[model samples]
Target: MDALSQALAKSRQTISAYEDYAERYDQIVRHVPNEREQASLKRLVAIAGTAGQILEVGSGAGYDADFLEALGVKVRRTDATKRFLELQAARGKHGELLDLLTDDLGGPYDAVLALAVLIHVPRDQIEQVLAKIAGSLRPGGAFLVSMRNGDGETDGNYHTVLWRRDDFAARIESAGLVLIRDDFNEGRNREEWNTFLAVRPA
Candidate 1:
């Protein structure tokens, strides 16, 4: 199949998976942030400042948003998945529906965060999405993203497109963001978890 066709198929798979999984997802994770997660969030808040406006894409159940809110950052939680938003609302958390591909980003915020979020975006859409992310940031605004690390793709319950650090960084830079942090945490599989912290130029 062609790239566009492949992407559509993947999106269908993920949309189905998340819709089915949203209720049970909190059982998998709804706890406090781990050390790594907290550190990254702390760094992001420090760069953006405590009172700065923040936007989170794919904010599943508002997990990351909880940490940022705890740090006194005002975060607008958004996810493409409706079920996730409903679950979040049930917990008295604020959220909005946002599709990275079709929806307006509507931001000139101090930071845009997508933790474990961008991996679902297909190859053809990554550049445009990243550019939108970069454009959504205020000057010198931070962009902290964590994506799966490797090459090629995976399709099953959800669609996953992994990446090499250098290659992904090139994409981020091309999107008009400057890389300031590059790190990885080993995962159970061969592909590690790659996290990049970048910022839109001031």
Candidate 2:
């Protein structure tokens, strides 16, 4: 990784930036789910059912959770950033403080969602993180994740360690999850983003 990537990866571990930006970020993004995300949610519902026990990692400000709730799904919302949880509390919602790398996930959940979340994991540790996510699921549980896809990011402090699809898929399989398919889009800032759905075997 280059200097920017190094800095971004380091920043991801320090939650202070998130602590200060949580409210402001929510103000900017706390809207209904976007089209692609809505599609992913619908697919997840199809696989996991509407009422599946879902554990959502990085549920910032509960934006996507609000939409999933409307579909009769209850989400165990969690984030590493305390401020995001506080903001969710301000919205009269509740969530837990979870660090996927070190904390006990407490599942066997029916499904797991980690939208734009796993990018925070350093590249070397992503396999371990992916394994934990898979292990946290029930035998037939579904998993949905989106991340910045590439080797690096142009943004100075905001971008996390990026990913390549092939590398990610290999890790997903190595972690014991069955890869379904993946989708990609050039995001607003020319950020290469990719989303993939996978499942644990029954």
Candidate 3:
């Protein structure tokens, strides 16, 4: 197979392994609490200007979803991992299996939360995914995403792409979104991750 196809195949296999790993996946992760995640959620709430319908893509274990709901925001969660999706469903949470890399799932949300999820997307396809995410939001709606910050390449059984800050920002902007804030924090893995809060341009 070509290099791109090979990479995609490898990525799918890695993600499938993660599905089987379930909560145990955290064991391999840095176990670092994402401060950017906390900050971004606060900004999202502020941009939303009150409780409103929010869509969270890659809502692993529904942690952020539950957090948002607890904060009085209505949250609809979705993830690409079937096992993770099922786990969220089993908890009586609202969520679905969704692949942002694909076109249109549902839409016009007040805001879209995608913390730490985009890292799984292949670098070449990041723009496509971002565009699809932007389309899911209403004009002036916000989109929050976080990714590992690095100039080097890294692969994992689950994560396919690691991105640099400038490159990721350029793609988000090209998707017709305006970045409102960008923050970074040290991860438990000893790597940095960037969180971006953006709005679909009106």
lDDT of each: 0.89, 0.84, 0.77
* Per-residue accuracy of model 3 over 24-49 as CA lDDT, tens digit each: 75445433334656666878977765
How far off is residue 200 in model 3, in Å? Answer: 1.1
Candidate with better TM-score, 1 vs 3 = 1
- lDDT (tens digit, per residue) of candidate 2 on 1-202: 7754554456464566788888788878738988888999988877878878799999988988888888888899999899999988988999999987678898889899999888877676788789999999999899999888888643445547788988888888999999997999887678788889999999
Model 1: per-residue Cα lDDT over 1-202, one tens digit each? 9776677678777977999998897778746878988999999999999999999999998888988999999999998889999988998998998888778999899999998889999988899899999999999899999889889988778888898988899999999999999889985445588889999889
Q: How many collisions between residues are there in candidate 3?
A: 1
Worst 10 residues of 2 by lDDT: 4-13
- Backbone clash pairs for candidate 1 read none
> What is the C-alpha local distance difference test score of candidate 3?
0.77
Model 3 TM-score on a 0 to 1 scale? 0.87
lDDT of 2 at 156: 44
CA deviation > 4 Å runs, candidate 1: 1-9, 188-191
Best by TM-score: 1
Candidate 2, residue 15: how far the Cα is off, in Å: 1.5
Q: What is the C-alpha RMSD of each candidate to the true structure, in Å?
A: 1.7, 3.4, 2.7
